[model samples]
Target: MTGYTCTSCGEHHEELPFAYSAPAPAFWQDAPTDVLEPERCVISGEHYFLRGRLVLPVRDADQDFEWGVWVSVSKDNFFRAEELWDDPKRTDEPPYFGWLATELPGYEPGTLNLKTNLHTRPPGERPLIEVEPTGHPLAVEQRDGITLIRVQAVAELLRHP
Candidate 1:
């Protein structure tokens, strides 16, 4: 199977399914309302930032895992995403583009500056992000159409001025 070569880790991957600010999974029903809400992708100035958990499907391993991601979205792509999020009927759009601001783990919150291209998958498949991480990662939890993610961890990333 031909796969995409990851720019971050220099590994060829056959499948890397990821999700953005998707609806929460069923297990997250007991979470606080705020925690159960889908994390918003915010645009500041010309860049967009999102703090949330992404579900990455490992085809070879036959399992899926979650990672806390912080992304800086491109201006044009951010606008496209806004449009898609606002208009549920517009599902034929292209994937949005952004940069992975930090590696999956190891560095302190504000120190890591790992820059890598991150693109959203086409609508309907949980918006896959294609990349690998070093160190420990988070887990995916969703319920009632909201993603139970690291709200505080992601908030710190956006709080930077």
Candidate 2:
């Protein structure tokens, strides 16, 4: 596949990045030092967060676009996830309600605080986040899927933003 020129950096990349990720929740930046953990699971006082993926189908491609993002869940749900962290049966757990904690770039009105359902996968995979049906651009893309050209556009937008 041909790579596109980055609008921001004006550099040519060899391939488009099908996946983007936020290392931690947006709140993590302002979290107090004492309430942090050295793992993917974060418990900032009463708020709980877990890293997961929000996937969108690529209409004309064989692969899907994925965002490695964070979701804030309740304390009880957080503990339940931790308890099944390594269990293959973890996928049996029902979806957990959460709020999107990552501010995904390139979306109007921002992407934080969107309602989501975190569905547990098997032991080795991150939970799959299903954005609630809405008219937001991100949600629309998730529901209707996007073309490869759109993927390229997103790659360009995020490359140096």
List TM-score per model, in order: 0.40, 0.89
RMSD of 1: 14.5
Residue-wise C-alpha lDDT for candidate 2, range 17-130, written one tens digit per residue: 899988778887554542544335565467889888899999998899999999999999999998999999999999999999999988998999999999999987889999
Tell me the tens digit of each residue's lDDT in model 1 across 1-161. 23444544565656443322323322233423323224334432333554444554443344444555555556676566656754555455554454555444323543233333444444443344433343323222221112213332232333331
Which stretches of model 2 miss by more than 4 angstroms? Answer: 6-11, 30-39
Give the Cα lDDT of each candidate: 0.42, 0.86
Instruction: For candidate 2, give the lDDT.
Output: 0.86
Which stretches of model 1 miss by more than 4 angstroms? 1-38, 41-44, 51-53, 58-62, 89-91, 106-126, 132-161
Number of the top lDDT candidate: 2
Return the lDDT, model 2, position 117: 98
Positional deviation of residue 126's Cα in model 2 after best superposition, in angstroms: 0.4
**TM-score for model 2?**
0.89
